[model samples]
Target: MSFGSFSLCKELQQSLIEQGYTKATAIQQQAIPLVLEQRDLIAIAQTGTGKTASFSLPMLQLLTKGTAATDNHIRALVLTPTRELAAQVGQAILSYSSLTNLSTTAVHGGVRIEPQIAKLQSGVDVLVATPGRLLDLYTQQALSFDKLEILVLDEADRMLDLGFVDDIRHIQKLLPIKRQNLMFSATFTNPIRLLAEDMLNSPATVEISPETSNLEAISQRVHPVDKNRKTELLIHLIKSNSWNQVLIFCRTKHGADNLVTNLEQVGIRGASIHANRTQHARTQVLGGFRDGSIKVLVATDLASRGIDLSRLSCVINLDLPFVAEDYVHRIGRTGRAGHKGLAISLFSDDESKQLKSIEKLIGRTFTQTLVPGFELAIKPIVDESDDDLYGNFEPDPTYLKQTQKRSKHTKSGSNRSRSKRR
Candidate 1:
């Protein structure tokens, strides 16, 4: 379906055309009409599904026909889980509302509150914010929910993962009881359904399965390497494959920083984004990466949320996440907007549990391959005794089978010479 068929305002339709958004994504086609009808909705969508546009487009048209916000008041609120996501949602709303006079501003922590306060005091039609910062602004009387006509909880699952449930309930209590509520999540887990019951009123649900062709847009492969040699393997792949604009995921902030440092020492332009970094630094690094001045962007999973890079063709999992669902979100960073992309994971023996969980979740076994010199040095020991199953489960026959199969796919004789800084 096309944006024109959504019965949107002319300005929004024009904006969509100019943005090159011709056909509506499945999420957009399904959710936009519900939002336009002012119905409470629960959208189950994954990353890179044009989920932002689904709501933003309808919101722009709806807000254009409503009463304008007064000082210290907002007409609509979009709550996100991370600063990056808040900014991303805010930007999408702003971009879609370009042809209209609707005002939009995003507020989040890690930045000065005084400036956000100023933005809210002047009044905004749409306020996109993180949970904590929104509450802080509310406590300071910087914004009011009295004028709120619509409430959107974007990335509901991520908010729960980040432990924003209490804040969400608090914010809900403060909102006008008679208003439209929309909740969007990657999954409709019990926690999300419970939250939806609390926030939404007999909402309509729209779910786009992640196992669809959207996932097929990405080519996935695994490289079996030692834990310590992941950095070397990453560098080798970047140089050997001549990859540019790679987004690498690390499990910890310290690990992300160390990886960037290592990459820089070898002449690869790299940067890191994580919770520990100031918002300013994170924004600067993202800007550099988007402009091609930075070859690689290393980020923790939470920090990577809401990062939308159209040209990012590759994503590397330096360390697999403990949560299997995160694997889907990480690779979703690429293969976006129907573009073909690549996702590579550096698998180690110790991460067998994570690997197994991920394969089970995605319903596909990754093709394991070994880089010539970066192959594992010590093989994992298998405990065949049935009695020791629960006690020693790290190295089972499944892991050994995968490892043994990996040896057959090792690349031919090649130079092990590591790339150096030119």
Candidate 2:
């Protein structure tokens, strides 16, 4: 259905028209009406399904008709998992609220707090924030949620995965219980459901897509190569295909950095994003990648959660994620907003368990291909008996030795206690 059927404010309709969004996505269609009615909502939708606009539009309409209280108390507060996402949500609110008089600001860590405090004190109608920075501002009394009308948790699943549950609960306790509650995520796993039970109040549930599926426009494929040769093959693919923009996912911070170094050594423009990097660096890397100045962006799963890249052409899995659900979110970087994209995974024999888990999660096997010159000389064996492949891969000898030492100490302590008793 068209966005016009939602009977939004004339100015909002005009804004949508100018932005070239005539039709509503499935989640938008179902969610806009409930949100306009001022009901608590739990929206389950994928990454690129226009979930941002679904709530942003309705929120603008709600706030425009209401009056602001004294002390510039925040009217709406949106909590996201990452700084990039907070910025993106703030931008969306600003763009959609252009015709209105509402003011919006984004607060997150890895940046100066004085400016954000200044903005908060000046009065903001909507505040988008990451949990850590928000807590900091709250503790310093730089922000107040006393007049909060609506509370939105965008990407709730990611927040939970990032160990933000305690932060979310703390924020929830500080909010006014009467405020409108909204929770949106890509999937409703058991953990997500448990978290929703605590946050939502008799919410209207909306699920736009199947729980375990990625976008249909993305073509998934796998290239079987040796563990050491994956980076070389990645450079080969990007150079051969002349791909302009690519997002590569690595399992660790070191892996991301190493991938970036390798790509640069081969004459490809690449940047890495991880927890160790400052917020400014991450933002710069993301901006460059989105603007097509950077050819490849290597990032860990946590660092890449909030990245919303429009028309991103390709996503390469340099290291398969240990969790199956992450695979959906990784490839979701591409095939956004009805655009066709490709997702390629570089898999080695050691990662077969991860591959199997992903296949089980997505309910399909990826089509495997072999690179001509970089193919594995000796195929690595996969052991079906080991369920925890990621945990069992003891690559660090020092760590294993430490574990053994700890065990021996514990046994000796038990024997000494028995001898003393005798």
Candidate 3:
């Protein structure tokens, strides 16, 4: 349905028009009207589904009816899982509420409080923030929620995963209990359901897709390669496909760094984002990646939670996440806003457990194909006597040391791990 059909304020309508957003996505279609009516809501939607707009647009409309906030008071609140999502939601609110009298601000950690405190002094109509920073601001008496007409917990599942339950409860106690509450999550796990029960009253429920479900618009596949050959295969895929932009996922911060280092060997410039990087550095790397200057961006699960890339055509899983639901979030980076995209995973023998978990969650196995000549070939780890006992990759000192510990868990007599699912 077109955004024009919604009974949104003229300012919001104009903002959407200027941004060239003609039609609303499914989640928007279901949630916007209820939200504008001031009904509490629970939206289960994936990333890249235009979810940020689904709530922001209606929020602007609702806030128009509320009186302007004075110093330290806000009419609406948006709590996000990470600083990046908060900033993104803040930007969207600012853009949508531009012509209105509403003032929007986002605050997160990893930055100074003086500027944020100053902004709070001027007051904000809509405040978007992470749990930690929001609590910190409250402790400092920099913000007041007495006038809060709406409370939204965006990415609610992630917030729970980040162990913000106590903080969320604390924020809840601060807000007027009778106010409107909306909770949005990509999945409604038991934890999310419990949060919703305590958060939303009699509410409208919208489930565009389940947690296990993936976007049908994205093509999903897997490549079987040895753990060591993953870097070589990744370089080959990018160069051969002529992919100019790609988002690669690694499980750990160290892994992300190592992947970027390996990428440099093939003359590929890459940037890594995680907790270690400062706010300025993260912003610079994200800016470069968004502007097409950086071809590859490597990130861990927590760091990748905040990244939203436009026309991000490819996502490569150098390492699958341990959490099954994270796979949904990873591939969701691509195939955004109805645009088709590709998600490729480099499957290794050691990652079998994770791979199985992903398949079980999604309820289907992705296509597994072997790259000709790049197929996994296990060479024996030659001993001091040059005796090949356990076939591993090139029996080098480093290779032997790494695989020696794993040789005992030998499944069957063959050194080669099975390429297909059992």
Candidate 4:
């Protein structure tokens, strides 16, 4: 369906044309009209389904027919789980409202609060923010919800995952009871439903199949290797395939850092984005990765929430997430906007549980294969006599054999020189 059928303001129609957005996706078609009618809505959609536009476009259309905000009071509020997602949603709203008179801004932690306060001081028609930062602004009297007409919770499931239920409830108490409420989540788990029951009043529902839309465009593979050899196998795959851009997921920030260090040692330009990095550093890394200057971007599950790169072709799971739904979000980074993509996961023996959970959640099993040269081998038993005075033991011959076999594929000859993207 075309967006023009919605009879949006002329400015929105012009902005949509300028942004190259014409056809509306299924969620957009279903949710836009409901939003326009001011009906409370519960939209279940994954990333890459044009879900952002579904809500943003309609919200902008509605706000245009109302009075503008003043005295740091916002007319519409978009709550996101992460700083990156907040910024992403804020940017999308700004782009959609570029030709209109509405003002939009995003606020989150990890940056200076003064600048965000300054932006709120000018008042905005729409405010996209993380819960913590929004509360901070409210406590500091930087903004008011008195003028808030619409309340949106994007990625509601993620907010629950991050333990923001209490904060959300507190904010709900602060908002006017008459405002319209909209909730979007990848899945309608019981917790999400309970939250919705508490927040919405007889809301309409919209849903998209997770497997059909999000995963169908992406090719998936699982390489079963020993836990210690994942880095080695990943290096081999990238160098051998000559992959120009890859997004790798790690379970922890420390693991992400280590993965980047290993990649760079092999002449591959890589960067890490996680909670430990400053907001400025994370933004810079994302810019480099998007522009194709960085070969790899290693990130944690939480830190990867708002990364929306349309052309990103490859995603690797260095470590499987503890939660199954996160696997969906991880691979969702690629294969966006009808583009075919590849998702590779390094499955180790210890992560079998995580793999099973992910398969069960997605309703499909993966093709498990071993990298030819990096196959897992049984370690030979070593005698106590092998230990030296310092209690150090020699390398196991079995492990050494596997390492040598893999080294042949990772030889320096294939280590082509590439300039750093930093």
How much lDDT does candidate 3 score?
Answer: 0.79
What lDDT tens digits, residue by residue, belong to model 3 across residues 1-422?
89999988888888888877898877788888888888888887677777788888888888888678997898889999887788778988898888888899999988998899999996799999999999899999998888889999999988988899999988888888778888888766677767777777776777664321236778899998988889889999888897768999988889899989988988999999887888778879888998999999998886556887667879999998776668878998887766788999998877666776577556586667999878778632323353542223222232223233323443311111111111
What is candidate 2's CA lDDT for residue 233?
Answer: 91
Candidate 4 per-residue lDDT over residues 1-422, each given as its tens digit: 89999969999999999988878877788889988988888887677888889889899999999998988899999999998899888988999999999999999999999999999997899999999999999999999988899999999988998999999999999998888888888766678877888888778887665433657899999988888888999999998896668999999989899888889989999999998899899889988988899979999986657898888879999998876667778999999877899999998876666776576556577888878998777532334363341121222233233323433452211111111111
> What range of 10 consecutive residues in model 1 has the weakest lDDT sum?
413-422
Query: Each candidate's lDDT (Cα)?
Result: 0.82, 0.80, 0.79, 0.82
- What candidate 2 gets wrong by more than 4 Å, as runs, is 211-214, 383-422
Tell me the tens digit of each residue's lDDT in model 2 across 1-422.
Answer: 89999868888888888888888877788889989999888887668888899899998889888886446479999999988899989988888878878888999999999999988886689899999999999888988888899999999988987899999999989998787888888766667777777777777777654421236788899999988788789888998896778888999999889888888887888999889999898889888877888878888887555788768889999898887777878998898776788999999987887787677555577878897888678977777686575453322233223323433432211101000100
Worst 10 residues of 4 by lDDT: 413-422
> Model 1 over residues 193-309: C-alpha lDDT tens digits?
678877777677776655432577899999999988899999999988877789999999999999999999999989999889899999999889888999899999975566897
Off by over 4 Å in 1: 381-422
CA shift of 19, model 1, Å: 1.1
For candidate 4, the per-residue lDDT at 411 reads 28
Clashing pairs in 3: 379-392, 380-391
Give each model's clash number: 0, 0, 2, 0
Which segments of model 3 are wrong by more than 4 Å? 210-214, 379-422
Candidate 2 lDDT at 168 equals: 94
Q: Estimate the TM-score of every prediction.
A: 0.90, 0.89, 0.87, 0.87
Q: Which prediction has the highest TM-score against the true structure?
A: 1
What overall lDDT, based on C-alpha atoms, would model 2 receive against the true structure? 0.80
